[model samples]
Target chain A: MTDTWLTSLITDTPQQGYELAITLSRRGVKYTQPDMDTLKKLRPEYANSAEGLTAASHVIAVNFQTVAAANNYWRG
Target chain B: MTDTWLTSLITDTPQQGYELAITLSRRGVKYTQPDMDTLKKLRPEYANSAEGLTAASHVIAVNFQTVAAANNYWRG
Candidate 1:
């Protein structure tokens, strides 16, 4: 939830870059919804349903696509 | 990059849920951009630039927000 979660996306290796991408995604969620209570409350509903889980994955893919594009597909 | 990357988002704990979210995001990118050569090639541009990194984070936040909402903020 801190602004400092990401200083730069420049990584020495692709593995590092990928890890950073995951961190960015996780931190993003924390920043957007700081309220732990709300997050915990809604967990069961989505966790129990296949549709909810798939929807979550779909969003992640969308975000990842943006990151990959920004990173130029991590091509060197 | 397999379709089986995510079968469900239901986790026993918040930690697990968060990890799953990260995996989903990472897998998403792989599924969308399967070309490692392209990803490596584009890494330097965004990796070295501040704007590119920040943009990546911004996209992550957006995606996380969507996931959070879908999970009802994970509120229990």
Candidate 2:
């Protein structure tokens, strides 16, 4: 389900996508906001997977580092 | 995964969470953007379910109607 959301965020449309990418760096999860252009260039495996997409619609679609950051950000 | 992101978006530490609520209204899927205050008062069962959240981190939590709108918006 999560993957579906991320993939949709990237694959559903090819125009200017709205993404939040904070992972590129630590642990847990990150809040990634990848733009449409960047989204187009990203590999499916790297960004969102088929199973993941099948699972849900909306997803964070980022590395754990960003997830943790976002969590911390919200907490703070 | 999708739900996790959204729940995090809401429950983790919601100050002013970012949500896209398109579901409450049509088909396919909707894009929703519900605010934090509202989120604080919403019932989790209705907003972000445990399974839904477990599925993904960034799911577009909305009624099917909003999903179609967002999809159309992105497609067009």
Candidate 3:
């Protein structure tokens, strides 16, 4: 959330990179929906549904793709 | 996490698509780290750090890109 955090996206390992990706994704949600109460209230609507859960995975895969690209798929 | 949840990635609106992306990202973390206690224990390490937070945004942007593509950026 802080501009100061805007440094290198470079991660030492894929595992670390993946964890970072998840962190980024989670924070994105927090930023989008700042209200914890509202987030919780909305959770049930999506959390219990199959469509909602699948949608979540789709986002994660997309995020992972970006992280992997940033890390050059960790080929190095 | 269930195979049965697999279905069309298509979404009606950008807002809905975005919400789905967030869900996918979240579910990814859950799938990766099933242990809630471990996940909670690791939270502070990244949640409080500036770099961690930014990393989170980076991933979110990446995810948004994918969702946008799926929704054709809602041009219709």
By TM-score, the best candidate is 3
- Candidate closest to the true structure, highest DockQ: 3
Question: Which stretches in model 3 have alpha-carbon errors above 4 Å?
Answer: A1-29, A32-76, B1-6
All candidates: DockQ: 0.07, 0.06, 0.08
Model 2 bad stretches (over 4 Å): A1-18, A22-52, A55-71, B1-76
Q: What does candidate 3 score on TM?
A: 0.47
Candidate 3: residue B9 lDDT (0-100) = 59
What is the per-residue lDDT of model 2 for residues B1-76, given as tens digits with 9 covering 90 to 100? 1332232222221212223332211101112223334334433533466664443233333222232332333333
For A1-41, candidate 3 gives per-residue lDDT tens digits of 22333233457898887776565566575765565775566
**TM-score ranking, best first:** 3, 1, 2
* Ranking according to lDDT, highest score first: 3, 1, 2
Candidate 2 residue-wise lDDT at A35: 54
lDDT of 3 at B74: 59
lDDT for each residue of candidate 1 in B1-76, tens digit (9 for 90 to 100): 3233433334555556556555554454454345666546555655577865665554455545434444445686
Looking at model 1, residue A17 earns an lDDT score of: 44
Candidate 1 chain A has its poorest 10 consecutive residues by lDDT at A47-56
* Full-model lDDT for every candidate: 0.52, 0.28, 0.60
Better of 1 and 3 by DockQ: 3
Q: Judged by TM-score relative to the true structure, which candidate is superior, 2 or 3?
A: 3
The positional error of residue B42 in candidate 1, measured at the CA in angstroms, is 37
